[model samples]
Target: MKRLLNAIRDQFELTHNEAKSALLFFVIILVNLLLYYSYSAYTVNEQSEILIEDYGKTEIPESEERKSNWVDYGSSYKKSAKKVERFSFDPNVATNEQFERLGFPKYLAKTIINYRSKGGKFKYKEDLLKIYSMKPELYADIENLVSLPSKLDKKTPDFDEHRVIAEEKPAFAPKKTFTISKFDINTADTTQLMQIKGIGKVFASRIIKYRDILGGFHSIDQVGETYGLDPTVLPELKKYAVLNTKVKKIRINDLENFRHPYLRYNQVKVIVAYRKQHGNFRNTEDLKQIKILDEATISKIEPYLEF
Candidate 1:
């Protein structure tokens, strides 16, 4: 302490009180340093801003697209369904293999069937987004694989309201005889259903045996129940179908009895679903299994029962 005091008083030429002032200045500098460090630490402890947007509407630059190169990094590249000549993607009709071909996980394929069975249809691209916990990236992957068209009601579209109208032949037309030469709706195979105009391979097959449990359609409107037939096509289907077409429901005891080879899958599914619910097909309503069922279908299948 004496050495410091002598150095301060001699070398610096400071008064006794001046040295004390110098000491006070050093202490203030130390306190300022500490306060600075503490304030910096506190301020740094809370520093952030939240962000909440992924890839929605960002302008992904045309120049970036132009500069993109074709690098072969994947084992194979998948094409969009729209790019392909023919790709099957009937959610109700796609097999597990077909589902995988469309790039959906196999585990979720059955869930998709359940979705369809519950009256869901892949009507729009957005519908796939509604799947449970479906990933956005996955939707981006398969967005192109989905195909949907507007639909009309089979009841209104395919019903032949003009059947009687056409029957009212004039005196000259009274001599004009009409002969039937088309496949019967009640017994036609998938191939046979195709003879009808506007019915494609997919729609034809679905119409014949979609709910094979119900036998044939009791009403022409039942045609609308076929896959891909939404309310939009009702006017079209109505032109070609007759509401009084002979059709029947499966017997309660013989839920397993569809003799048509084309209807095998539908028949078996109906039996299984029937047994699952009521153990027997006492009524057409027993067919709520295999997929979705509705009052409209039940009414259609109710007319031609033997049991």
Candidate 2:
């Protein structure tokens, strides 16, 4: 012990008294820690014994209320084994009920049905793995059961020709015709817009939303600016939708907060700050004074602003 203290003193460049004091302090801490842990272990063991004794003696009475309230977590966690029917069936033609009979969960079966309803096809057995919820283990088990073609003949030289001919033949079938009528773009609601040939629920909703953001459409061409508007549908849309209503304009001086499809956030901030620093904009000429507002930008928004 004396040699260990001498070594520590020499190694740390400490005096005899400092090294002795440190050693004593360390010993005291070690003793305290051991005592603390020993007491904790004894306390824990005593509590455990008490719990065990109480559990052996305790009697829980059976009652309907208790039974109803009590939950068996062990049983809840255990999955009920589904009866899997191993049978060959075409994935593209299989119904939801048939998928369920083949051990697929109801939700996954519905997913397959929805994919088919949206014109998705399974041309190969490997395509079954394309489903997000399809487990590799589950697919491995049923891989032989998929009745799709082994592989697509992608290398066929005349495949494109045959496909084009098949598509062109469908053109000869008499197409169901519907009459399209003209309606005011600004005043027309979603139901009225959906009545047009090309516009559906999604596009109709987007048109109304964009119009609301812009305070209303100023011209028929502005409807074409809607996000994801199909170019082919524009002629049909223009044929039925007319911009006859006057657009609501934003007052330059009284504008507190503005939202426009054309104006970005920072550009708007600069415009508002310019108004505060200089004066309210008189016309498009005053807006051109701000370097950020270029000629084309000012021209685009000129119709929507009022002095």
Candidate 3:
């Protein structure tokens, strides 16, 4: 050891005290490096232990955590939720409290109460199915308990058989025969026309008003042309009513001709222009020359026009 120290001192060109001081300084640096390495390893191990402990506290398996959360949620829900009760009820007349007691939800109970308050009636037990919010399972459960009538009962007369027979027996059974008398359409008054089976007061008045407008009826079919007259009653009217051919006529030159129902404004204008350009209308056929008048119209107005 002395020889090695002497060789080092000679190589470095140092005396004993200077070499000793340099050796001491080298030993101090080596001790500091060892101490630094030891501190670094200890610090890394301690950090790893701290990280593992923190992860163990904060992180959990997803499935196990979810299960725990669901248990707590269910307990909370049970405490907060309303308890449903089941009972018989008539939906049409049942109060809101009764509806809820019969296991109906709050919203559904309010809807039913509002419906009943608005004059809505559930005529039959099956009508409860009309509620859109009604659940099939819920309806099925209480369907039998709904005390509503399913259908209207047939009405029966409460007449005593012997009394009805005694009262209904007439002096004699009348013979059944049918005969209808014909009448003139032109001259028949309202009361006389109403005697017909189908002609009521309104129809009789309409017939008279139309006849007056036309001056008189040229054919029994003209009665069918009366406004508001039922077409179904036309055949009956034709069977009982006859028109007199002797009817009043309006001259084509007269301004009163415009009042004719068959002559519209355009047709009246055409007729007046044509008559001014030409002479008076010689016959009903002369009306066909007017472009506004069609063949059907000429035929319809022919009976009412007397040259």
- Among these predicted structures, which one has the highest lDDT? 2
What tens digits encode model 2's per-residue C-alpha lDDT throughout 1-307?
Answer: 9998867665554456877988999899999999999999999999999999878677778999999987553332222124678789898999887876676666667778888899988878888888767666666767789876555545654463355544444446678787767889999999988876556777789889999888888887888788766555677777788888888898878887786878998899899999999988888899999999889988999899999
The weakest ten consecutive residues by lDDT in model 1 span 71-80
Better of 1 and 3 by lDDT: 3
What TM-score do all the candidates reach, one by one? 0.25, 0.42, 0.40
Backbone steric clashes in candidate 2, count: 0
**Which residue pairs clash in candidate 2?**
none
Better of 2 and 3 by TM-score: 2
Which candidate, 2 or 3, has the higher lDDT?
2
**How well is each residue in 53-172 modelled by candidate 1, as lDDT tens digits?**
333455555665556853332212233232323363655567767775665554466678788889887765666777774557656665556564323323444233234334654565
Question: How well does candidate 2 score on lDDT at residue 211?
Answer: 92
Cα RMSD for candidate 1? Answer: 43.4
- Per-residue CA lDDT of model 3 for 202-287, tens digit only, reads 77888899888878888877887876455666777777787654677766666544567776877878888898888788887678
Best by TM-score: 2
